[model samples]
Target: MKKIKTNVLRLLDQQHINYETREYEYDDNHLSGEHIVHQVDLEADEIYKTLVLHDHHEYLVCCIPVMEEIDLKKLAKASGHKSVEMLHQKDLLSLTGYMRGGCSPIGMKKKFPTYFQEDILLLDRVAISAGKRGLQVILKPQDLIQYVNGQCVDVIR
Candidate 1:
């Protein structure tokens, strides 16, 4: 496997955040977060999916379990907006510098308000993307929240 230097890894290292990298075979058809949990040999509850959402005017980042779905009404309440929608897939790369399946909450073109499913705090460690398909960064959930200034909210259904 070739080494991939992702911005997410750099930021974590700079902050002295302890983490482990888990890489699996890349397959678009089998790369959902649920599948990643199995591929990486981790629990589904400990792996998360990063979603970019828009309330029409601004974007917010939401992290939820791969096996769960975000309730838009809850997301709207969390964002203090009337409605919340997932950002268009077409706009992902240009706006956040991440492709659809490889978006990590940590290293983006700019920082936006971020939210994590409150359930993350229950786990000692959580697995997120390494800013690339087929790679995961496993680290303390507390470290991630502190590093990203993320809010913990109950927006997942």
Candidate 2:
């Protein structure tokens, strides 16, 4: 199978950021919290998913552990917005150039403000979407913060 061009990888290369990529069989509709854990052979808590949300006026990106759900109110306050609502799938696609299952914190069409759960920093390494289904990137938390200019906050409940 041909490799999908991921902005994450491109950005990493452009900035000389180090990362490791792993690929599995493409599943197309594999966005469930459990699938990623199995694919990466890691505990559910060690993997994270990115959610694209809009506070009506601006877009924000929230990264939280796969095992947890984001508290919209908390996320909104953390992002400095009055309210937070999930972005539609179409909007997510148009804005990030990635489907729901493949949204990466790095390399988006635009740099939306990013909030990451503070607990994620405790992990030595974590797995995040590599811009496509069946693809994942393993990197250190610090590397991700530096690469994406993410703010560590209590965005998850």
Candidate 3:
């Protein structure tokens, strides 16, 4: 198979980050992270899904394990927001320049305050969207955190 290229990959390259890419089959109905984990044959917690949230005035980005859900209150506290809500699906593309199911924290149109679930710190490596569906980038969790300037906090329930 031909190697795939994506904005996320390019950004990692520019930063000289070491990473590996995984390509899998995907369709509109099968974009869920569970499906990606099945296709990639990795532990569910090893893969994370990117989410966008906001506190009306600003957007916050989160990368959490696919199987876990964000604890809004915890997220708010970690992000120093009075409260936060998921960014509407309609606004996802316009705000991040990436579609739902393919939003990666590393190469957004603009960087928001990015956070990773503290669980990620337990993993040696983690996988995240490569700025597109059907692909993922696996890298050291610390490298990813540093490259995106992301904080690891207990934001998941």
Candidate 4:
């Protein structure tokens, strides 16, 4: 099957961002980032998962390493909201034009404010979903932060 050119990949190409795309077998058993670690043969620290959250007022994008848990309270404060809630699974496609497990921080229907764990900057490169299953995009953390205009804050535990 031909690989799909997801919006995330196209956006990076359009902006001339340096990145590497890796494809893996699509299987429900290997869907989680932890399982993906073995499939990609990369450490958990080198993979970031995209999460969409709503701070009561607006939707926000949160990226965290696969093993890390999001500290919702800190995220809310960092985003200047009283509280933040994970978007319902049913709302994922409508709110962000992304299906569950295929969201990318690079290209969304609406440019929701995005934030990442501060520790991501310490890593040289990280892998994120390429807006599609079976596709992974690897890029420098700093480059992703700049391209997405994402804030690096302490939002993960």
Candidate 5:
């Protein structure tokens, strides 16, 4: 079997950002939250999940702690969009260069506006997708924001 290359790590290397990748066997049936919690052995509150949304015209990426749900209205308001909805699986893959369960906050096909729930910044280090299932990278939340040029907002319900 061939190993898949993770664009997340590639981008981090290109930017000279220090990150460490941890991998395990991923079960396709597991929800992202479950995978982060069980496979990665991280608290659900400290693991952030990336969600792709489209406001009909433009795409946006929202990162929030796994235990929280996204507030579409808040996200729309923060992005200055009239409305926001979750992107379809196909659109998500096209936009982020990742599949539904594998989307990472880093290494998007194009740099779209990104926003994160402000509370995530309170963590010294958090785990996020490493561009694939069964893999995650532990890094400071601030470092991720700086690297992605993401705006911090209270976009989680």
Candidate 6:
């Protein structure tokens, strides 16, 4: 299979960051995290999904394991927002330059404060969207956090 390149992959290369990519089969109509993990063959804990949320003033990004859910109250406190809600699906592409299932923390059109689930520190490697669907980038969790200027916080439920 041919390697696929995306904004996320290119940015990692430009920064000389070490990472690997996994391509999987996907259907546009069924873009669930469960399907992604099944295709990539990684434990749910090692695969993360990016979420974009806002408190009306600014957008915040969170990367949590596929099997987990974000605790909005905790995220609000961590991000210093009184409340936060998911960014609308319609605004995701224009704001982040990626679709719902393909949003990666890195290489967004504009940098936003990013957070990763604290437990990610326990994993040696993690897989995140490659800024596109059906592909993932595997790298050290710390490296990913550092690149996105993200901190690990208790954002998962």
Clashing pairs in 5: none
Tens-digit lDDT string for candidate 2 (1-157): 6766577888777877677877756665765787667766777777889999997889989899987999999988888889989999878888988887888888888998888999988998888888887788888889898778899998776
Residue pairs with colliding backbones in model 3 are none
Query: Candidate 1, 43: how far from true, in Å?
Result: 0.2
**Residues 29-104, model 6: lDDT tens digits:** 7777788888887898999999999998899999999888999999999999999999999999999999988889
TM-score of model number 2:
0.91
Over the full model, what C-alpha lDDT does candidate 1 score relative to the true structure?
0.90
Off by over 4 Å in 6: none
Compared with the true structure, all predictions reach lDDT values of: 0.90, 0.83, 0.92, 0.88, 0.84, 0.92
Name the regions of candidate 3 deviating beyond 4 angstroms: none
Per-residue alpha-carbon lDDT of candidate 5 for residues 11-52, written as tens digits (9 for 90 to 100) = 887888787766767777767576567776667877888999
User: Which is the winner by lDDT between candidate 1 and candidate 6?
Assistant: 6
TM-score of 3: 0.96
Question: Model 3 over residues 80-101: C-alpha lDDT tens digits?
Answer: 9999999999999999999988
Lowest-sum lDDT 10-residue window in model 2: 23-32
lDDT of 6 at 142: 86
9-127 per-residue lDDT for model 4 (tens digits): 89999989898888877786666676777787678998999999996678999999988899999999999999999999899998888888788888888898999999898998999
Residue pairs in candidate 6 whose N, alpha carbon or C atoms collide under 3 angstroms: none
The local lDDT score (0 to 100) that residue 127 gets in candidate 5 is 79
- Candidate 2 Cα errors over 4 Å, as ranges: 1-5, 26-30
Sort order, lDDT high to low? 6, 3, 1, 4, 5, 2
User: Which residue window of length 10 is worst by lDDT in model 4?
Assistant: 26-35
Residue 71 error, candidate 6, Å:
0.9
Q: What is the lDDT of candidate 6?
A: 0.92
